[model samples]
Target: MSINARLFYVYRIVSRMYFHLSVLFVYFFTLDLPVWKIELLLGVYAIVLLLTSKLNAAMLTRMPHKQVIALGELIKAGGLAALIANEHLGILLVGQILSGLGYSLAQGTDSSLLRTIMPDMQAYKKAESGSSSYTFASFLLSGIIGSIIFNYSHEYAFWCSIGANAIAITAVLLIREPAHTNTQQEARGAKPTETSAQKFWKLYYSITRAFAMATFVGFLPYYFFTQTQVSLNIFGLILSLFTLLGFISARFIVRAGNVYGFAKIAATSALLCTASMALLGSSSYLPFGIVALAVLGLASGGVRPLTLSNLNMGEWTPTQRTALLSSMEQSFGLWNAILLIAGGFAIDSIGFQWLMLILAVVYVVLMTVGYWLYHIHTAQPTAAAEQIQ
Candidate 1:
């Protein structure tokens, strides 16, 4: 691995550690607050994230990527500081807003920077997968460590998160942007045959895949505990297993995309996710549910790297790539906010099983239609060019 790739992996590890350190403490810290207030905090955070994504997209043309990443990390550390104080609901809301801004600013740029620095697309894909695996590993380790720390003091956990963020910021600062990046980007400009419609579909697929995974992550535990009657201890073990499988899949399965093609791998992943979700909804058997969860985990982990590989295949300019990726992040935040509001109402109205089944069918229809549209749009241009020739 190159120095940049190593530094990137280090950044991923510590940044993810920062993220997951307080994951289990969100509800715990807000226990005294009303449910409505907690929801308000989440709403504030999501809105801030969406708005900041737009801002980040606009700023990409003017700011250096490393500077943006470092500034975002600094801001995140400040946000963690506020949470560490934890005096009032108002303070917590401020913390969430700061964290959201920081997260949105930094989220898409790191991958963009990695792509810019690496001349070889294959190396970039490998590094991307490796970084993702590191992230998942960090998630597992940080969760365990955070839980242990939280058992003693919440403040200590938040402080440790800030320390991790600081380390990530340092890593970002150490990364040297290649001087030939722009030349390489220009040399590999989008193919003449590519169209805006094709680009849109590629991005759309990624956004949809991310939204589906987010929904599952948000709701699966509830469905398992309430509907399937899984005990807490067993559920925790299952979740750990899921995370482990995700790490392994990200590390190894993504390489298969090079052999079988990313599009095929992505489609297969989507199908697997749909099947797993449907199976979970249709069955009450504990073993079946566990198997479904495991499949979902593997699919979810590999799908992200595949989608990212697809998105970058166009060889867009750094600015264009960053803007599009930021837009995707914005879409994710919007969809997630919508899911948080609607998914609860859906479960209340129709129950978790029905909701899952409906979502499965809906996703299938969407994917089919998206593929058809992509085919029509791409085929028309090729046919026109051929006739002109």
Candidate 2:
């Protein structure tokens, strides 16, 4: 990894640590508030995040990407500081809005900056292929440390978050924009914009894939114990294996991307993801279930890097690219919200087997439709030109 990429990896680890506690802090700190009020604040937070993702896109277009990164981190820090100062519901709501906006901006800008610094496909892949591993590590570390700290005092969690963000902000300042970024911008001239059809399909793919992935993660443990009657010890082992498999799969993404290309890899992973879900749903044997979960983990990890690399392969300007990525992230946010509500109903009313089966079918349909559109657009030269035009 290049210097910038290494710095970015560090930034992600720290940033994830801080964010992992954000919602927990709110819940514990606002324990005296009515449940409905707390829910409303969270709802507002969702809306703000979705809206600000789009706004962040515009900001990226007009301002320096590095400046946007700094601004975003500062906003997030300000939000954490708000909670420390006051525990009022209204204050928390405002803080959530700032936090959401900051995250949207920081995330998109960070990706854009990485692309700017490491423009080569192989270089980018090398830099980012271990992202899932980093996330898993940060998640584990933060979960342990944050829990212990929160147990002592809820305010301590908030303070730690604020400190983490401060460190993240300093890291952001160290990221220097590559000189080639300006050259590329000048060469491309005006930014090429995405057609509505292109945007719609990208968002559709993100939403459906995210929903399926979330369902798999959320339901797997419950299904395993309830249906398979697996021991908790074995279940924990399976989960750990899943994480390890995911990390191992991530290590191979760049090589896989080089051989098959991003779109093809995405299409293949989506198919395998469908099969894995189906297998998990249908298999009654414990060994089969274990293999299926491992396949799910592998496919999930591969799909993320491949899809992101594919998305970043386009010729759009940096701002446009980051904006679209932000939009895709928002699509995920929307899907998660929908799934949280719908998933509960599906699980309670239909049962886990039926729910997985339903999701498997959903994945099949989504992958079919997505790849169909993908082929239709790319298969003909004229169709491709019309899309760009």
Candidate 3:
């Protein structure tokens, strides 16, 4: 990996560590709070994250990627520092919001920076894969360490997270900003390889995927606890298994994308996810539930790369590219906000089985969208072939 790539990898690890630890800190501290309140706080975090992405997009149009990223990291570290200093609920909420803002600002900018350093599709794939690996590792380790530290003292967790955020900020500082490109000039010269319709579908896919994941992360544990006989240890292990599968699959994204193409692979992933939901809804058997969750993880892993590759396809200026991708992320954030809050209530009232069934229906709809994407992908090449002949 290049120096830029290596630095970005370090940044991802620390970023994930900071996020996981911060959230865990808030969570363990707020054990006395109502479930709805906990969910609401998370919803607030998602909303802030989404809103900040829009603000970040506008800022990116005017500023360099490195500056935006560095500022984001520093600001996030400040939030962690606040958490370390205060135990107030209000202060914790503010810290979470700031953490969300930090992610919003840095999210698209890192990818944008990487694209500038190495514009090839392969480089982009490698960056995404490396990011996925580091993120999974960070999440796994943070969960373990955060638990240990929280047991020792919640303040210790916050202090450790602050240190991680500081290190991430330093990594961002080490990365030099890539040369500035004139967005307007590039936009004027860009060819039209993708239609507005394709762009809409890509964003839609992102939104629905986010909704599904929010439902899983926010509600699945409750589902397991209330509806199944799975022990807490088993639940944690199963969740880890999913993360592991996702990590492994994400690493092979580029090769898989090349062999099957983005849309077909995405469609297949959606189909598998649909099946996973169906299995979850229909069976309470431990083995079946494990299979369902595993399938869900595999599909999630597959579609991530597919959707990323699809979003990066088409000719656009860097500003346009980053803005559109950022918009997609914000859309995900919006969906997460909505789903986490509403799904909590729904699961509480309607029961976990029915909730999974509803998600199954949503995935069914997504499967249709995936098929449509596949059709468009196939038709584009055929239309090109005819023109060449």
Candidate 4:
């Protein structure tokens, strides 16, 4: 493997370890707060991500990718620092804001960097899939290990997250900067090949899928803790199973897409997401919920590589690619913010099961309409094709 690929693998492992650890611990740390207040923390985090993504899009052209990524890791570490320093709600909010900003900066740049350095698109896709698998592998390890660590000492778990960020930052430092061919094209005022309608559809798909996945994952711990008889260790193992499937799925989803077609894979993933949510909401039985989560894990893992492959399909300048990816991330943040805030209140009123069922219905409508619009837009031939016809 190339140095970049190896470093990227390390980065994925450590960064996702940080993420999984934080997510697992954050719930218990804020357990004293009302659920809405807890959810508000994530809502605020999403809002910051949405706003910062816009800022990153504007600044990406001016900044070195490595520098931006390194700075993001540092800021994320600082955010973890803030979280561990105090358990106060106000401090936690500050931590989340900083974390959101950092995450936004680093989110899509890795793939951009990978694309820049790797000459072959297929190679890049392989590397991307490999990195994603590494991420989920880390997720699996961290979820179980972090839970165990948290059970012993919350301070240790948070420290491990900070350490992971530190390692990631070091990895960023070692990465060699690539020639910015796409940025140079942008500098010369070359227009992107992607149309506005295409961008809209991309954002639409991103928002719907992200909202469903985020909502499901975010509240899953609470669901298992409150609604089921599962123990903390068992819950951790369940999460391990989830990420294990995700790891497996990410490895093959791209190949599956190539064979069966991306549209079919995407559509099937959406239906799976819908069914998983409905199944989860319908029954509190452990087996049923586990089955639902497994389905969700499969859907979530497969769709991500598919989406990334789709996004990387067209001829796009580096700046445009980064900006477009940022926009997708921004869309996720916007909808997730709305979901977290509204769903918090909804959870307080209607409870988790009812809220989940409502969300499942909403997802079905949103995805169906999104796919319909996408079909309409895509079915129309390009100007060149029309002229040839």
Top-scoring candidate (lDDT): 4
Residue-by-residue lDDT tens digits, candidate 3, 327-365: 777877887888778776776677667777887787577
- The global Cα lDDT (0 to 1) of model 4 is 0.73
Worst 10 residues of 1 by lDDT: 20-29
Candidate 1 overall lDDT versus native: 0.67
Where does candidate 2 stray beyond 4 Å? Answer: 1-3, 18-49, 77-99, 130-133, 144-162, 178-205, 216-243, 260-264, 275-295, 312-315, 377-389
Better of 1 and 3 by lDDT: 1
TM-score of 1: 0.81
Question: Residue by residue across 295-370, what tens digits does model 1's lDDT show?
Answer: 7777777655655665644457666677777777776677566654556556657776777787778767767786
Question: Where does candidate 4 stray beyond 4 Å?
Answer: 19-31, 179-193, 196-205, 377-389
TM-score (all chains, Cα) for each model: 0.81, 0.70, 0.82, 0.91
Q: What is the lDDT of candidate 3?
A: 0.66
C-alpha local distance difference test of each model:
0.67, 0.62, 0.66, 0.73
Q: Which 10 residues in a row give candidate 4 its minimum summed lDDT?
A: 380-389
Clashing pairs in 1: none
C-alpha displacement of 43 in model 3, angstroms?
1.6
For TM-score, the strongest prediction is 4
Residue by residue across 1-389, what tens digits does model 4's lDDT show?
Answer: 88877887787678788534424424543457777787787788788888888565555667767677778888888887887778788898999999889898888876676676675888888888878877888878877787677767666777887888889889877877775333543645754666534554465457655655565556676677666746667877886767877788888888887788666676777787888889878987788888888888887776556667766444676677777777788888888888888887778688777887988898888777765665466645454222211
